[model samples]
Target: MASTAASASPPPAGWASDPGVSAPLRHVRAIIADHLTHGPTDPTLAQRRAWRDALYDAIALPPDVVSTPVRDGAVRGLWQSSPGARHDHVLLYIHGGGYEIGSVRSWRVISAVLARRMGVRAFSVDYPLAPEAHFPAPVDNVVAAYRWLLAQGIGAHDIVFAGDSSGGGLTAAALLQLRMLGLPEPAGALLISPWLDLTNSGKSIDDPPGYDPFNPRAGLESFAHDYLAGHPATDPLASPLFGDLHGLPPLLIQVGGDEALLDDSVRFARRAGSEQVAVTMQVWPHMFHEFQAWAPDLPAASAAMDDAATFLDRALADAR
Candidate 1:
């Protein structure tokens, strides 16, 4: 969902590029194109995992953050924090990879960045991947992780949930699941380019208005299939866009105009807004998927992170 009201800010400056952003940062679209051409496209599980791991492993994390291993029943994750962190506040971060490949190690840099930016101790889940552990498994693991946080004495009001892409869908679904089972929801949620519609029901996905260098529609559809593993894609829990949006926590969603998943965010924002949920949606022009992954280097990414940090700060304050 994009900025639904006048309160939301617009995109960055020049080429919509912030000043001081290097040529490498500005050349991101080209870089992605080049990488895809040279990168392996093997759909084989082993090959796919290797490619993803290599790509994410190359992301450089700042040296000062600490990431400690932790577990909650079947869930495994990393507790990430920086000097700016509050030991009492917790963020449950779910990583994207269509519920298949991502892990806490792969998302360390982003987790660390959020920890510093939001001044909270963040936990990144290493939920079991798909083809091996499909629907319900990943979502359930997220629930388990949240319960673990509760058991640690972190109140629901002190914790926030967040994720990107499929993980974003998981965050929304998990919140819905919690509410269904009489569990308290978190303070709020932050979704980055969330893949909320598994049915590819979003119009923009088929008739995209801008160029998206990555994330082909068919490829994403395939990932959905793998994760569903014969389950119904239209199930509200699987494709949260079709689900009831009422009574969920505050939501802050950021999405790129150029991405195919644009409508997924847009529709979710509209639904949430209709449901009277507090939602601040920011639509960044001409940006790519999960652009925030390159934050502090790319102006757009940094700006998006700042937006998220501000939203979370306000939401947490309101919760308190």
Candidate 2:
């Protein structure tokens, strides 16, 4: 087992000790923490891309997994743990990076874990980012990727969509767009601390300072504006919070209690529940948005992953 303190920096303010994380993840978290502390002053665009790819490789997922290019020549990922009878189900993963960062390579570890747990192959799309690729671009790319998946003989009913933060928002928007286009819906959707409201209308945004460790309120507000770039924030596709939840697939939302986006998840859950969508919202206390990505070593982080796995299992079974 790796030492918890081997690579760890002091816990951020308000973080309590957790015991659910594996030793390997603890080592990973420590390395990430060190990077966070003294690595780069300001990362350039190329550097960010390199960093994203490096983080993915650091997860050290199996080398035997294969990847293929998708729409716009972006890479689409596939991971299968040791050969077995292939399952009919699939998971299409869209990664989070505030719509300006993140890629399939950066989320390989997460995809691998989901693939192992769900007994299904996981596919991650490397969608275009913002500031260069603006509103509707990323969403359009995801839609194209899904269509590509369908073209590959995968049934929509056997697919589940999952993403974190901004990517989660994209997942919901993509589903809505699919419905609009008369395409078949996926079996289920999973959101991790989704940034559903680019408008930042979630009531939780009103919380006092020092509440969320990872996300500074002002920084997120800035990110929203930068990503939207003069577009209307209330557009249902941009902010799923204002969209119609009717006829959407069952959804599982996991959010941290202290996240600024907490209200976004809560409000979405309430609306989805009212619309008779099978919705489960799990809130972990004192954790920041996307805490699992930052502290994969913590017990809470692993528990969150377990929660996601269980949700996927039940939802996929029901879909079957």
Per-model tally of clashing residue pairs: 4, 1
lDDT tens digits, residue span 59-117, model 1: 67878788899865686999998886898888899998777666778767666787689
Using TM-score as the measure, the top candidate is 1
Name the 10 consecutive residues with the lowest summed lDDT in model 2.
Answer: 1-10
Q: What TM-score does candidate 2 get on C-alpha atoms?
A: 0.83
State the lDDT at 236 in candidate 1: 82
Clashing pairs in 2: 20-299
- Residue-wise lDDT of candidate 2 within 5-69, one digit each (tens)? 21112346323323453455445545545554543335565565565456545655555555544
Q: What are the lDDT scores of the predictions, listed in order?
A: 0.79, 0.72
Candidate 1 clashing pairs, residues 3+ apart or interchain: 1-265, 2-281, 3-281, 3-282
Query: Which candidate leads in lDDT?
Result: 1
